[model samples]
Target: MKRVSCIDIGTNTALLLIADLDTQEGSIKPVFHKQTIIRLGKNVDEQKIIDHEAMQRLISCMTDYKHISKEHDVQQIIAAGTSALRDAKNRMEIIDEVVRACGIVIKTISGEEEAALTFSGAVAGMEELPETFSVIDIGGGSTEITMGNAQTITGSVSMNIGSVRLTERFFSSQPPSEEEFNAAKEEINRHLTEHLPPFFEAREHVYGVAGTLTTIAAVVSGLEQFDPEKIHNFRLTCEQVGNLLDMFRRQTLNEIMDSGIPEGRADVITMGALILHQFMKLLGTESIRVSIQGLRYGMAWKELQKLVSDGETTNSA
Candidate 1:
């Protein structure tokens, strides 16, 4: 019952999960979880830095996570940052501030590395995955697409089209009109056309991971509680996604928040739907299996293996 923790600081959200890993079973599962939505990249494009407002909020959350990790007697924490910090002009400044305030040094990883790690995590949890599968990781500020065989990753691409950026640039107005949604869809299609050729040319089963795809799972399942097991391997039809987009557009923001959906998720849910719809169209896949595991899970598993290996050497000596 040894515990480990991982912190994934993405553009739209900062997630922390501390799990009691039964590595003796060759699988990793989280017994405890904590997440905070600081929206770190709130205005990075305009400010050229992590916004001060968002940083303050993140500091508060990270400070709280620090306390929780200690209280739980957790050891070995790995932290990473995604698109926002990757593209920001003042990323180091923000990273310094985070380290200063919370004792967490966040690594801003490249999109390719993000794709590879996510693939490793997704593959680890699956009963069976296709030999020629495509894995897509959609985030707040970027998306990573990997083409892989059953054994290893073949090639990958990371694009800057993400839920938050797309929503901000195109669907800023709530309950976006058809014109707005189409414009965003067209842009997403254009980007996909330009960037996704190698992965899209030959596809088997496309696995989707991240909040966007999971929200689709949530909407389709209509579950008030977020259940990873139920959503994992769940598929949604293109027509179903399209229909939901249409219906979602008719509802106001207040209506969306008032529903069973969590308040922190309200702002980008529609935009996330739009992104996934376009991805399905471009891949010509009617449906995609939801991957509940991503970077946080990946980081934890990697660290756990290293720890167990080190422990074995110590015991032998």
Candidate 2:
């Protein structure tokens, strides 16, 4: 089968998906997907540029991805850059370097576009999208919230309150102190309150996507091997969120790292979870339905939909 790939380069991670696309009854499905943590935005918010080490790590990842695609005979690819790219001063230079080194073109999409694409991806497998479903895609550098119905969009907002960004901005501790955690949560809640009210009003279900949410789902389900099918659409209650947050608070970063989390994730998972917990509390939501689908899946599905609508075969460009 021919393959289509989507690469999402965010502040904290770089994700790659190579899928065999299928179109039947006006629906598209991805057959394969993979993700990695590159932490491109590691210290960008503080340093103001994609740091040298982070840039090199990213280049290596992209080079490997390009080679893998070639080995698989894959041709069609969509590469997108999010928050860090949007804010970096030397973004053009960074983009040029990636293209020269990896043979891949990267497009930096707007916040609204990110939210919409994520919403499309998250809702792709659902039988019916709610009239007022709030889809949240929380990244390392930013968070996107989209409120919409089955056929039309209502409002979309992207905020600069992600795991990496938040960790650097506040709670600079091995394990965040209660005072620090409370202060951090207050800041998040304050920032969110300004923009979230319009989006949260009359919302029915909250579908959370991206690394933070999925990681929480994985830990919650106690899955030895990550299973999206088993956890996607699974709800996490506020009480459950509080319990997990408390559990992580008791364990140090090294302990969590030693326990089982991927090394790259040990640093920021707690920060991400705390932010998520506050968001859920602010929205007065008891639970959130997980969506393994996100921006990369959304972008690929959009292109596939255009192809199918134009009555073209699932052929690669």
Candidate 3:
């Protein structure tokens, strides 16, 4: 078994997952998981660049993750940067800085790859894996929806519409105006109608991942703080989602936070929630399963596959 640390640096947050990979069994046992909200994609949608402050936060967050990985004595550190990096004009410069200072290479992956990885991660370790399922990962700068099964993905699409992107575009105030809300909704609908693949239609089983879904699950379950145990595999239905959206529309950022939403998440939660709401409407599914494990976990499993393949190649050589 080899210990591997997988870090996912997203537009809104950075997550770390340290796991033990068994080459023989082709499985990964998670050791530790940590997430920090750095909003690395801050204003990337508008400015098309990762600003100075965002870069600083990225460096600092990676430094901390590096230290934590060392504490676990991991054999390999795999880091990935998603939509935030993909949109930022200075992404490579920021990634290089992380490599130089934190000694961690950050891979800026395409949206297609992100959706595939999300599908893999969402279904990992499921006791009763669905025959076929779709994964919707609502990120800060983009949303990835992929349809797949236990074996492979059939289709996937990564939309440029995300919570942070929409919030920044339309919302200048907490609890944005009704006009702003409708505009955001219209934009989301436009993206789905134009780009979403037909494979998603009639797919009953769906999994929701990333901060938006998990946070909504948390609030639905009435937890005082973030709890992964109660979150994983939790059911989020269409009715509940609609009610939540109505409640969010009535509440300001501070009010949302005071009601137990995670810091750095409450502000954008409404937009995120709206994305999920519209997505469910398009799919015609009553509910979706929530998955806390996402890109970071997917990266860990992919690394294990690579590690095992390399070992086989080495032995044959």
**Top-scoring candidate (lDDT):** 3
Query: Mind giving the per-residue lDDT tens digits that candidate 3 earns over 1-317?
Result: 78889988888999999998877777778899998999998899999999989999989998998999899988789888899999988888998888898899998999999998988988788878878788889999999988878888888899899999999999888788999999999999999887665656535889989999998999899998788989999999998999999999889888999988877999999999899998888768898999998888798878878888888323210
* TM-scores for the candidates: 0.91, 0.94, 0.96
Best by TM-score: 3
- Number of backbone-clashing residue pairs for each candidate, in the order shown: 0, 1, 0
Residue clash pairs of candidate 1: none
**What's the lDDT for residue 95 in model 2?**
87
RMSD of 1: 2.6
lDDT of 1 at 263: 67
What's the distance in Å from true for residue 35, model 1? Answer: 2.3
Task: Tell me the deviation in Å of residue 254 in model 2.
Answer: 1.5
TM-score of 1: 0.91
